[model samples]
Target: MTVTLKNGVLDPQGKAIEGALGSLGFSGVGHVRQGKVFDLELEGSDKVKTEADLKAMCEKLLANTVIENYTIALD
Candidate 1:
């Protein structure tokens, strides 16, 4: 699974940090995106099960349908 930021949402915290960095002499910065962290353990240690479980978790609990997006990867 993969994660991404929800489109058209105003990320004020990320934006403020990005704007501040520019004024402090940082250059060539384009987009500063931010998202949430999702952590969980499942019954199986296989990649397919983990991915499936993560997708279900994302749909059920880890992400907010109104504002954020998320993805899953096995460690």
Candidate 2:
């Protein structure tokens, strides 16, 4: 699962990193956004059920839905 701040939401950490990159002589870098990635191993083989459960987890705890968005990618 990946969670990221929504567009138009202020991202101070991203901004700070962008500034630091500029200070380090990395030019033309802009609009940096930060996010989270979760790697999980589940016992179930049901893809549909697993996706549902993952979405529930994001909605309930992993992500702040109001200011963030999440995506689930399975491998």
How far residue 38's Cα lies from its native spot in candidate 1, in Å, is: 2.7
For model 2 the TM-score comes to: 0.89
Q: Which tens-of-lDDT digit does each residue in 1-75 have in candidate 1?
A: 444568788778778878988999999987776666655555766888778877887888777767777766787
Q: What's model 1's lDDT at 20? A: 89
Q: Report the Cα lDDT for candidate 2.
A: 0.95
Instruction: Output the lDDT of residue 14, model 2.
Output: 89
Residue pairs clashing in model 2 are none
Model 2, position 28: C-alpha lDDT score: 97
TM-score of each: 0.75, 0.89
For residues 1-75, what per-residue lDDT tens digits would candidate 2 score against the true structure?
999999999999989999999999999997988999999999989999999999999999999999999999998
Off by over 4 Å in 1: 1-4, 41-43
User: Could you give me the TM-score of model 1 versus the true structure?
Assistant: 0.75
